[model samples]
Target: MPIRQLPDTLINQIAAGEVVERPASVVKELVENALDAGATRVDIDLEEGGARLIRIRDDGAGIAAEELPLAVSRHATSKIASLDDLEGVATLGFRGEALPSIASVSRFALISRRNGAEHGAALEIDGGRLGEVAPKPHPQGTTVEVRDLFFNVPARRKFLKAERTELSHIEEWLRQLALARPDVELRVSHNGKASRRWKGEGDLLSDVRINETLGEEFARNALRVDHSGAGLRLHGWIAQPAYNRASADQQYLYVNGRAVRDRSIAHAVKQAYADVLFHGRQPAYVLFLELDPRRVDVNVHPAKHEVRFRDSRLIHDFVYRTLHDALAETRAGSAVGVADAQPAYDPAQAARPDYNWRVPTRPLGLQVEETRAGYAALYGAPRAELAYGAPAPAGEAYAPPAGLDGPAPHPALPHSDDASLPPLGYAIAQLHGIYVLAETADGLIVIDMHAAHERIGYEKLKHAHDGEGLRTQPLLVPAALAVSEREADVAEREAPTLAALGFDVTRSGPQSLTLRSVPALLAHGDVEALLRDVLADLREHGESRRVAAARDELLATMACHGAVRANRRLTLPEMNALLREMEATERSGQCNHGRPTWARFSLSEIDRWFLRGR
Candidate 1:
């Protein structure tokens, strides 16, 4: 058979294979088109999981009556025209293939009336057969009705899941879009009954929207992030380490208002959470990255789910550093005050139909050194003195230090309205030889003694390591490993990076390499496997931190061993000193293993426990 150009109908059907995967895919394309039309409110009506019927009515700038036919034509889009426009495309539906592709596989009808138009026009297409445009009654907007989706393509229809499953997919996608455009009002109905509604308002996203989209738990545990610099602006909420998920289902990332899945960004987020999250657990967040549209390419994939950045390394470093700095402040007692008064769990507040919660505010940065100095003066001891432990009888009652039964003022300590209430407050007792029970101005604080100490030690070790870089240990006999030419090239090109990471590598042959030295901290690791993994990462991501991560893992182990052991009794002074040290230390909220070091129960929570509120 000789090669020939495919028919127009067949060509559209083929494009449908890429743009229309299921009922959810159709919804995604149509909703994106509506958003691109500058729709403020979109009403979605579906029947049988959008398979039998899908009607989307949007109050947006509708298309002209004369342009109705062109809307169903392939490659005819109002989004972009010239190469410059394509390079900086901002709209969601730029491909212009969705309408024709979708029309080819289903029964489609588009009716629209421009604002102030006396009449509306409708264009019908059934399985790629276009009908003449005719006058129709319509509001001052656009309404697209699709029936029997994929009806012409039995194979495609067969692949669709059950009605409930398809409906769930549609809902999930809508939720993601809702997060990106909180200003766009959206409502969905299934089988003639309302299923979901989001009333858009305000210039910025409200906490209520977060609660409705992500959940109340996330809204309560999330940290507001707003950092702008170096031609990039990242603003959104990131979940605290304690609020992680078993899977990464809740991680919603958007680039320049378009939802995308970029590996470099994802890796940066993972690296940022490396020190705080458990090894297997994933973080939940709704992050938005804003940058010049020209700096990123959105047309890399037909589905438009992925993007390519011009400066991936710069973006990665920026994301990593911003999140890293944010997580660091959560340590010590800097974040304790904010965490204490986080929104309480309210089922009714979350379930309310009207989303109108006030936006949560982020705390102003506090001077770490100044706060540490204040804590040091109040404790009347150095961090080193507080680190040592003195053995005491287990389960023995802790007696307050002499002349410290009540609040005592120290001239060296800064005076404020809440001067008496230190962030962690004062230790009152010990629990189970593992937890330190203390009283704060707000409520009770329970601390994992071992975990807290482990974090303190880990931060100190990291600081020391940072001051005197990684120490390299020369191998008595250099290890030789065979590798592919690509790996060898990477090894040669990244030799400087390896050296900086305390590794010395040299190419001995065309496809072979020799490792002469390794970081002292990672000397016992599988050097060959480590090198292979590092090379793979560098080749793919243009950067690798496996060596540094391995070193950190070893440091974490040392910190764990050096931390205070459970069941080790402590006197009042020792416990109090530990509390003060925790307040002054960084990343003290979590241990090296990502477990939270402490938790606070507000006074109201205590009241509810005993039904005192009733």
Candidate 2:
């Protein structure tokens, strides 16, 4: 074989191999083109899962009669004209290969009226052969019709899935587009029957749209997020830990209104949810990342499904920090979707505790001093000072000293209206030796007493440990660990990050490192495992949470062992004290093990349960 120029038809067919994977790929390209043209509404008609026919009509600025031929010409596009335009492309269809490549494998027609033109024009291409452009009757927008997709390439056509499968693919892509552009109306018809329609919505997102797209459950549990920093804006909805999914199918990411899949941002999100989400569960989110076009490269993938960021580390940190702060606010009383109500006082219930006690359970032998020390900051004073305090004599029913009590009962105002009342309301009773029953303004709240106290203790331990900095434990003799040259490079380059994480590492050779000191909190743990995980994380994500994660694990164990145990009797004041501390804690909704600590049973739901609503 000798070097030779490929024919235009063969070249387009080859390009189609990259841009057109199936019916879904074709829809993705043409729909993106419609959106880029400034369409506010798009109508799609598919036959035989878009294998036999695909007609897309959009109310956007249309192509001109003279430019009709160039619209289907390879490497010719109105989207970009220079290197500068390519470098900072804001449009969805800049490659110019979609129309030509799509036209090469199917019967295609392009017709438009240029928004304000007197008459529409049409151009046809069959199997890469073009016909003359001619005047045609149409509306003030563009209409692209493709018939017999992959008709010229029998092999490709044979590879397509069944009718229902292919239609599902097209529907999925349209769903993604709908999420990104809620302001754009989209209607779909299959086999002459209207299947679905997404009405034009307000702004980038809406709670109604989330419910309609993802389901009512997601909408109810969704947490609204809108943050901007360093010329980047990220806004969307994230499901609370209580509503997480087993798979990541519900996670959607859009970059500057273009849907894409970036693993770096995905990993960052996962890391943000690491402290709360249950093991083996995935979080659901619909996040949109908006940054200056110059800061991101969208030409990396053949289909523009992935992007390369200029400052990936910065973006990662920004995303992680934003969501981390948001989740921290997911404390006990700031219920995501629960409505607030005025306190409804019932003096009788406040005095008469619910004695739903269970049989004798194994006690954890928790100490009053330990619990007091861990929660001292929540009230006032240091752990050292609180640790010396003593509990009231045993066998005394629920009565504590003055300092170990909740707010004083007000005589004039409604009991819960007092300024000292926390958001979780006041504890009314203990249930089944394991739960705390509380009276909110609207209804009853059941709390897992042990789980709640464990979280409170764990968070306090973490705060105290972090505030002291990452204290290092120096080894009498340094130890050398061999690793890949790349790991050695990361250890050398990220020395500052490593040091901040309480690591003193020096490169001993091209593929080895000497460890001088380790985090004092984790000195007794696996030093080799910790260093390897940290280096791996830094090398890939430009950051590592292993140090903090390790330290947290130890504190969590301590808190769990020291937390108040089941079957422990408590007075109203003692229980109220726990409630106040929980109300003031961060991430108190879940324990350190990712289990929920409390749940709210609304008044309406209770009414329905008792058949009182009827």
Candidate 3:
């Protein structure tokens, strides 16, 4: 087959496929053009998510009558004059494919006056065919209207989402653009009704804009971060460590005034928050990075959503370290206390719970002991002095506090754990031809032989009673616990609970706590350092678990210790034994926690993945 030339209309349509993926794409391109034209005020109106109608009016350098016809032509622009300009392209748009691509799939009209013109000229293009250019409107700026989008391309039209979903996308586009250029007042309307508007300079005013677009609650609970690093400056606001959203849709990022989605930046931000937030929970942030535009590439996508960076590692570390340090500073202040970071306590409705323990009077550190005997001697009922880096045995019959119920020694009850388990039960099920299950009955039962056990061990040490609810090993001398003013407040409120959990604490000063005795569970653990760490976690995560739930959760962690792991292959009897354990355990129906330990698809569902089901 010989290569042949594609028709102009078809060429424009193909370009449209890349540049005009949705109504929001159209808005974005037009808005970028408006801003590029040095528009001070832009008004955008849409109907049917820019399907039926879209009108963008901007007070900018209007198009000349002679240039009006070429405006709808492809590869025509005044943004770049030479190839050298491409290396330092600072404007939002430069490709000049926006107008032609938009006109190809939609009924496009442009009316503009070149400031000194007697009257504005109008040009119309329907399905990529140019109509006659004539004098029409009386305006000193430009106003573009696109209607009946995708009328000539019915297939694209069919792929459009619901009006609301499309409108949401359009709104998001407008928001990012507005944020990028806060000096340019922007007003967006869908179906002739106002949806969002922004009026301000593009500083760290994202909080105000977010409030206007999302809600006031976001504005009130935002954490403002403004810092500069080597060759890069970052300024934005993140929700308090504890405040989070269900989706990452609320996370907005901009590099050098251009909205972008750089995975490295996102990963770095997440790493900075490692262990601070719960799994699957996303934090809300409006982050902006200011750097030399020459160091970044914005030409990766036709939509300009993703960008390539020259030094991604450097940028990532800068963003992560800046936000992380900023958060620490804010947490230390009384204006944003530990209580304010908690989600469970609403300061607007009710008084927040005491979390004074989050304030630290000492530096933080970590140490691990392997043997049960080592742990026992270090933090036993009668605490003993022990040397560091000592090897110890693994197994011991450790007991819970005097009043609490310990694990049962008798055999588990006879029952099918899967059949009796509640919704989301079935902790772990055998995956092979034979079905094996693990569950908990008494307190919490783990199903997996591996994952459950590891998770249980991790959580046990995570929430153990060493200081708070676990037993404590006393230091030869009392350690000083650093306490922030807010942490002091939290400690004062939850002192009784802390005491019940085996912590003997006293307020040493305005910003200090004195430790007398820690819980037996944490006997060897550094009481001074752990309390501060716990205080920080509590501030960010809210109150530690209540007594009842705490006990169950701890038991669940313990159960996870004995569950099967994924890689640990078992014999038929071992699998059968695991099944019996799950059946005997009460919570065995599910994992130690609420996550589904197993999911069973019927024969029909299995057939679907293989394309066998019709």
The prediction achieving the highest lDDT against the true structure is 2
Q: Write the number of the candidate with greater TM-score, choosing between 2 and 3.
A: 2
Q: For residues 1-614, could you state the per-residue lDDT of candidate 2 as single tens digits?
A: 99999999999999999999998899889988998999999999999999999999999999999999989998888889999999999999899999999999999999998977999999999999999999999998899999999999999999999999999999989989888887999999999999999999666756656766888788767778899999999999888887888898899999998889998899899989988888999999999999999999999999999999999999999999988887876677655641222342222222222222212231112323333443453344453244334444697424434474443331221233443344566667788889988876567788898998899889989899878877999988898999999999999999998989888999999999999999998898999889999999998888788888888888999999988899997665567667666766778888888889989887778999989958
- Using Cα atoms with residue i matched to residue i, what is each candidate's TM-score against the true structure? 0.87, 0.87, 0.56
Tens-place lDDT digits, model 1, residues 1-614: 99999999999999999988898888999999999888999999999999999999998999899998899999999999999999998898799999999999999999999998999999999999999999998888899999999898898889888999999999999999988888999999999999999988844446667877887777767788889999999988888888899998999999998888988889989989999998799998888999998999999989899999999978988888899887876654434211233322222211111111211221111122223333354343364223322223466524445565533321222222342245665577889999998776567789998999999888889999989877889999999999999999999999998788777999999999999998887788787898898899878777777887887788899999988899988655467667766766767888999999999887789999999958
How much lDDT does each candidate structure score? 0.81, 0.82, 0.63
Give a tens-digit lDDT track for model 3, residues 1-614: 89999998999999999999988899889988988888988999999878899999999999998898788888999988887777667888888899999999999999998888889999999888899989987568899999999999999999999988988888877777765676788988887789767885554553446666546666655766778868899987776545566789788898878888887788767755543344687877888898887788877888778888887757776887787665433211113311233222122111111112222331111111212222343234222113123333455323334554422122333233222222212223444522334333222222344532333343445445433545445556777767689887666666775776666777878888777777654465455555665555345433342332344444555655544445655543233233322222222222333333333333455467789945
| Model 3 ranges off by over 4 Å | 200-207, 330-333, 337-614
Model 2 RMSD in angstroms: 7.1
Please give the TM-score that candidate 1 achieves against the real structure.
0.87
Cα displacement (Å) at residue 402, model 2: 20
